[model samples]
Target chain A: EAGVTQSPTHLIKTRGQQATLRCSPISGHTSVYWYQQALGLGLQFLLWYDEGEERNRGNFPPRFSGRQFPNYSSELNVNALELEDSALYLCASSLLPGQKNTEAFFGQGTRLTVV
Target chain B: SQQGEEDPQALSIQEGENATMNCSYKTSINNLQWYRQNSGRGLVHLILIRSNEREKHSGRLRVTLDTSKKSSSLLITASRAADTASYFCATDAGLRGYSTLTFGKGTMLLVSP
Candidate 1:
């Protein structure tokens, strides 16, 4: 089975612009998570979506938002982007909680560069 | 905020040697997982140790969890150049239903051949 997949491996946007990143989870996975890895900042959780519902979120601002589709794929949209928003955005998927396999599988990530 | 913090931010070792990284978290966790990331690419799940478990081993990787100390350690034996990557420890803070993992800053391991 294919692991999680992300599109637009790299994206470039100017400050105040908007950026969108996409992710498709594994075939049988039902939970999708987004993380941001910035230089020197480490990996930070952004959002968690389960069964098409926004389950939890991180400390990020309201400008960072995303949604999970019916097919379990997810899209992350960053509006009014700032230079600090530039980072490697990763998406991961796993079996829903209470299932046997809850280990998350991650995508290659989309590197967003805000100029 | 990140719940876990990895020690020795980075490590450099020779192939065939052993590499050990430690992680410490603040809150109670249901399970702790280790992941490996090559360069800036995606992360690969390495191992998971539940709260009730103390030690677990997989292939050349051995993970030990100390719930009493709120810490965990990952050891890679006979390391290879291919094992050079950033290793992170994540904690599942949720106790009941779902779990959202909080990752640490990660330890960068460089194994020289």
Candidate 2:
């Protein structure tokens, strides 16, 4: 089966601009997760969406948000992007939340560079 | 939120040697999972072990979990150049009804010939 797919392998934006990253979950998957991997900052959880609802989010700022469509696809929006936002954003999907008989598969990720 | 913190942020080993990475978390967890990520690529699931289980093995990968100590370790036997990557440990907090797997900073492993 095809793995999780992300669009715009790489993106460039300026400070204060808005950036949107898109992801399509594996077929039949209902949960999508967003993570950010910045230099010296490891992978940080950004948001989790399941069944078209925002299930949980990490300690990121409010400007970092995302939504899951009815078809289970997801989009992550970063408003007022800062140079700190320059990092690799990954999208993953699983059968359900947690480790309850579910394993996540990640996408190639979108590398966002903010100048 | 990130859960565990992996030790030996980076490790280098010779091919065919065994590689081990450790992780420790502060909160209680129901299960812990390990993932591998190639440079500039996405992560791939390696293995998962439940709290009640002490050890589990899959192919060349072995995982051990110690709930009392809130620590876990991943051991890759017969490592190869292709095994060079960053490994992360994710802990799933087994709350009443809501549980989520939080990942760590990860350990970068470099296997050379």
Candidate with maximal TM-score: 1
| Per-residue alpha-carbon lDDT of candidate 1 for residues A1-115, written as tens digits (9 for 90 to 100) | 8989998999999999999999999998988889999998889989888899888888899999999999999999999999999999999988864453268889999999999
| Residue pairs clashing, model 1 | none
Candidate 2 lDDT, A53-97, residue by residue in tens: 898888899999999999999999999999999999999998856
Clashing pairs in 2: none
CAPRI rating of model 1: medium
Stretches of candidate 2 above 4 Å error?
Answer: A98-101, B94-99
lDDT of 2 at A66: 92
Q: Give the lowest summed-lDDT range of ten residues in model 2 chain A.
A: A95-104
Model 1, runs deviating above 4 Å: A98-101, B96-99
Recovered share of real interface contacts in candidate 1: 0.52
Q: On residues B24-107, what C-alpha lDDT tens digit does candidate 2 reach at each position?
A: 999987778999999968989999888899999999999999999999999999999999999999887855112266778999
TM-scores for candidates 1 onward, in order: 0.96, 0.95
Query: How does model 2 fare in lDDT?
Result: 0.89
Estimate how well candidate 1 is docked, as a DockQ score. Answer: 0.56
